[model samples]
Target: MTAMLEMRGVSKSFTGVQALRDVNFTVRAGEIHALVGENGAGKSTLMKVLSGVYPHGSYEGAIIFEGEERRFRDINDSEALGIIIIHQELALIPLLSIAENIFLSHPPARLGIIDRDAVYRQTRELLAQVGLREHPDTLITDLGVGKQQLVEIAKALSKRVRLLILDEPTASLNEADSAALLDRLLAFREQGIASILISHKLNEVARVADRITVLRDGRTVDSIDCGAQPVEEDRIIRSMVNRDLAHRFPERHARIGSPVLEVRNWSVYHPLHPERQVIKNVDFQVRRGEVVGIAGLMGAGRTEFAMSLFGRAWGRNITGRIALEGCEVELSSVPAAIDAGLAYVTEDRKQLGVILADDVRKNITLASLAQVAPRWVIDDVAELRAASDYRTRMRIRCSDVYQETGQLSGGNQQKVVLSKWLMTDPQVLILDEPTRGIDVGAKYEIYCIINELAEAGKGVVVISSEMPELLGICDRICVMNDGAFVGEFASGDATQEKIMRAIMHNKRTSNGARESDMPMEGVRP
Candidate 1:
């Protein structure tokens, strides 16, 4: 079979920074090509070149598609040729209906007026193809992340996509959703649609990809043919990061202490829907030198409980009794929460955690600006010194502290978030999906940091969707179902089966609880 697409001698640079070296890549007709790399490894950049995000003259390369050389001046040029790219950060107008988003660029129209019936009729067929059962008139914001992802694909299909590129498509999706999406890709292959999948989930890639391309620091390292032999995940990791990963999670020695932070009868109502209780009345505690993991299905109220406790970021009419070091404290707002020696690392890092446009130095000092300022006067020297120290200590891969956080890879971006919260010097830290979408090596490093945080006598609470991750790192696991904690297990007693059983048991007994998993996109592969 002849190749459908070929990139020859592709090299791109930005202001003296070489983002991609001389690279060669090829995708055959009707094949699922998996691209693997650490964050900032040039996978996205190469895709940008293909999709015309960087345009034709921005880089030096020859893009031969379907037996012809092509120079796409812009995204429209690429889209006109049946090439469409779906971004991980979903781009959808929340207020608009599903059909509208699907046919946003080019809708069926007569005399420059949209034909509504044609839009709905065609959207229904596209949605069915993607296995999404939502009505065409349903608002995009009403759907979960998983469904939104499908809508993006359906939108791509609407454009008559030939070469589909997905960047970190399943980074935020749960195992089931991720599996379904991969299966959809296979189905698309049956129709002769070639897919270029970029993801950090090695298991998913290994399961679905016909060919695997590894990129490291702007260079093509290897292109393994799965048809010839199964690709080992460790081998892929070694090529992507230039080192053999000895472990996914670091070993830890526990030194349990007395309860450092305690919460009693905590309750919170939905911010908008006052009648709806988001967090049920609950009692929770975190001991000094302890890493406690909250394990639950998506929308099981884990994040709601954490965010509510962190100065009621997620809910209103909150009622809670929080005691730190045996003294009850009132945290009515975010500033008060911070003043009370509490820090929360949010799950929605792109939106709530990091200011993407800001340089690393400013972001590092954002949470605790008082330290870098005295008497309301700015101190640039102290801030720079502190940020520089953290960049080095966290091993944040960047050109310098002056570089924008958005320019860093996912792993490095996560490290910067961690650095920001650590700078606050809080007594208790709450980390929500701390290692989500990062590479295996980066995950291990984050695990080590968590362990070190516990060792330093700072109480830690971790909320994660991955059962194995919670089991691997936490001293104890608390299972939350619906809006409350249903079960608790010591690290020795905790198992994925037991945790899941707790959830199942809760669902069976409570009338108000979700009988099935909540339709929220979560978990990391």
Candidate 2:
């Protein structure tokens, strides 16, 4: 394979913070090259420089494409040269049809008028190429996260993309969706389309990558060619973190106590559709000083149940009995829940978890303003002191607490959200996908935080798609399927196979079908 893209001596800085430092990256003509790194290790920054998002002359680098040096003034210039970047956040408009989004910038036009027929026809071909069966007329909102990802790829294909860049493409996808997306990449490789995949999921990287590049602290650490030699995950992890991580998860000794949080006959109806019940009658309990895990596939209502339990932030016609230390509490609103010693860290940190535009100090103190306020007047000194304390404690890598939350990395932003909730001094903390897009090093830090919370005699409920994570950290695991608790297991007895089996069993019972009739491949990671 020939060199498709080469970034030589790439260096980028922002406001005196060096984001990239002499980083070197290369991708072959028809290979899937993986770019793996810790958050803030400059992977995204380097890609932004290459894709012209940072533009020419702003970053120190020489971009060589197809044996020729190229200077791109903007993304359009790079796109014209067959470069397309799909960010982690899907850029498609939800209201628009798939066909429209695929050709939003460059539609099939006949004399300044969009040719709908041609657009739809081309979209169908692109979708087919990506193995998406949805019609071109289907709205992007109507599709699942996995299908939306495929549409993004099809859109890139529409632009004649020769070098495709995907950042955390499978971060929000289920196991089946992730597998399908990986298959699409393989198909593209066969067609001689090169791809640069930036992901924190090392398993997927090892599975599909032709070459793996490790970036650490804004510099290229090592590049491994899979065809030359088989690389173990331990080697990649050590290279990325610059240390031997003997265990992926930190060891925790559970000091189980009495129940801290209890829920009985909890149920929730869909907010949009009143007739549909999203959370069935469920009974759950988390003991003080214990870390409980909720394991389920996507759309299994894990998030729905968590959101509903935390002050009814989601769902309609919610019915539940929540108890704190054996005392029943009425949590009708967010404030009531907070007052009743309940805090929730949302899964979608960018959207619902934190105010990105605000500074870290503001975000950290947002949930518990009373702590920093005296007589309803916020004391700036006290607020700063409080924020500074949490920032240091959480190990949030930023210039200062005054820095904008949006400017921080994913792991740091998540810490800010956690800091905000911790400020409330809640007895029960519910975390949803706490380590979704972070690197292994950062994930270890988050797990340590969860253990710290549990050690403080707080009931911690963790809901995650990653089964391995739940198995590693939780004292007890609860399996949820189709809005109900299907099975429960202690950490000693829990296995991925057993949890998956419980899910299949529930499907068999609920759908009134044979066990063999249900497919479990899609749900298992």
Candidate 3:
């Protein structure tokens, strides 16, 4: 079959740095071609070049689309040729309605006057095609991250996109939603639409992609057909890293000790609905030198539970009794939680965890500024010393501590967040989706760090959607359902099946019960 898109001898440079080197890639019509690489492997740069972000004169490359040589000067030029690139970070207006967002740049108009009804009708049809049940009149802000992603796809479809490029589309979605999105991609393929999927989820790539291309150091390492030969994940990893990866999850010794943190009958109400409690009465405890994992499906209130405990970060009506080292403490705000030896690492690192514009040194010292400063003025030397210590400890790879956090890879940025919290010297640390977007190599390093924390006698609570990840590192697993703790099992006793069963069992029981008897919804993942 003739290639739908092709690039030959492509090369790109940025500020004295060679981002791409003699790269070659191709995409066939009506197929899913996956692009896999570690962060900063020039995947985004190459995509930008293809989509005209770099323009023709700015790079050394030849782009051939549909048997015609094309030199795209801008994003609009690429879009006009039926090519659209959806960035890693979504670009949707939160306050706008779904119809308005879908037809933002090019609205349905009659005689240069906006036709609101036509826009809604067209948007509704597009949403249905994407298998989204959301109303076109619904505000985008009220929708969850997963629904917002569907809207993005609907918007692309509006432009009659032929080559769709998705960058980390499922990074924030739950398992069910992620599966639904993948199904839609397959549907699109059946309709003769070509897709260039960029993702770190090797399993998903293996399942959906017809061809896989591995890139390393801005160069094409290899491309293989997933259907012709059963491609092992390690083969792809080896191509990307050029090394044998012995283990994806590092080994850890569980040294569980005395109870360090305890929560009894914890409950929190929904922020918008006072009568609707998000976290039901729940009881759990974490021992020193132990890592506890929370497992659940999306909307199970795992994040809500963790945030409520961290200085009431999420819930409005909070009712909980927390004890640290056998002493009761009141944590009403974030500052109070930090003061009480508690630290929270949020899932959305770019949005909630790190200040991207700030340097690594500054972000590391942000949490515990008082430790580096004797008086009101911040001591630059002290701050640098503290950051340097963490940089060494966490094995963060960067040009220097002075480099902006935004420039670092996803894994390295997560390390900076961990370093920031570690500087606070918290007794209990909560890590929410700690390894969501990082690669296996970086995940191993993070696992080592978690083990180190437990070895130091700190209590750790981990919330993750990946059951394998929870099973690998956690000493014990706690299952949550509908904002309530339904079951708990030791690492040796817990399995993915059991945890899922527990969640389902609890959900069924709660649904059968009265509305008044329903538990609050703030159960940690």
**lDDT: which candidate is best?**
2
Q: What TM-score does model 2 achieve against the real structure?
A: 0.96
Candidate 2's displacement at residue 417, Å, is: 0.6
Against the correct fold, how does model 1 do in TM-score? 0.94
Single out the weakest 10-residue window by summed lDDT for candidate 2. 516-525
Candidate 1 lDDT for residue 500: 91
Error of 3 at 33 (Å): 0.5
lDDT (Cα, tens digit) per residue for candidate 1, span 90-187: 99999999998999889999888999989989999999999999999999999988889999999999999999999989878877788899999999
Question: Which candidate model has the greater lDDT, 1 or 2?
Answer: 2
Clash count in backbone of candidate 2: 0
Global Cα lDDT for candidate 2: 0.92
Candidate 2: Cα lDDT at 295: 92
TM-score, model 3 to reference:
0.94
Q: State the local distance difference test value for candidate 1.
A: 0.89
| Deviation in Å, model 2, residue 137 alpha carbon | 1.5
Please state the error at residue 300 of candidate 2 in Å. Answer: 0.5
Ranking by lDDT: 2, 3, 1
Question: Per-residue error at 404 for model 1, in Å?
Answer: 1.7
Query: What's the TM-score of every candidate structure?
Result: 0.94, 0.96, 0.94
Q: Please list the Cα RMSD from the true structure of every candidate, rounded to 1 decimal place.
A: 5.7, 5.8, 4.4
